[model samples]
Target: MTGKINSENGYVKVEIHKVFKVLLSILLCFPVIGMIVLILIDTKEFSPILIVVMLLQVLMIRYIFIGLAFKFLSKDSLNRLRDVLDIEWIKNQA
Candidate 1:
């Protein structure tokens, strides 16, 4: 325990790192879904720049997975996500 409380029932307490990992893990799925949606739908009207940006975002998701697989990193390190609000790790994000 970090001696910090983030809601507890005396049976379970969530640590700052635990919450950070879970949120990042869940959000990493978004890019996959976006790629699928793009594949399934027609986007001929979309500008070339927009399509390129979307593909770059999709590519960044792979790096995010790699970062987590190697070491604990903040969302800023992950690049596509934001730091958790008011969480303890926000200060160490850099």
Candidate 2:
């Protein structure tokens, strides 16, 4: 099936999007894997600040992961507008 941004009679974008989604999921999963590994294997004492910082980093990655997953899953129209829709024209209309 062609996606919202597909070329007529060509499935390139859809194929690319499927591949992109898979790759993105994998990319997003790696951080969780690393965090789990650190929690499981790291015996080196980390300060409270360090633990908090690491947790924040994981949260940051997870947030991006969720946003990207939503964008990929949505049929284009459902996307939450972000940088791409931050039009200067609209912003400066005042």
Q: Name every residue pair that clashes in candidate 1.
A: none
The digit string of per-residue lDDT tens for model 2 on 1-94 reads: 3323222221112233577678766766675576667767875853456556666766776677556766576535323332354422112123
Query: Lowest-scoring 10 consecutive residues by lDDT in candidate 1?
Result: 5-14
Whole-model lDDT, candidate 2? 0.52
User: Please, what is the TM-score per model?
Assistant: 0.32, 0.37
lDDT of 1 by residue, 1-29 (tens): 22342432112122347676687666766
Best by TM-score: 2
- Supply candidate 2's per-residue lDDT for 80: 35
**lDDT over C-alpha atoms for residue 79 of model 1:** 35
Positional deviation of 32 in candidate 1, in angstroms?
Answer: 0.9
Q: When superposed on Cα atoms, how far off is each prediction in RMSD?
A: 11.7, 10.4
Candidate 2, residue 76: lDDT: 54
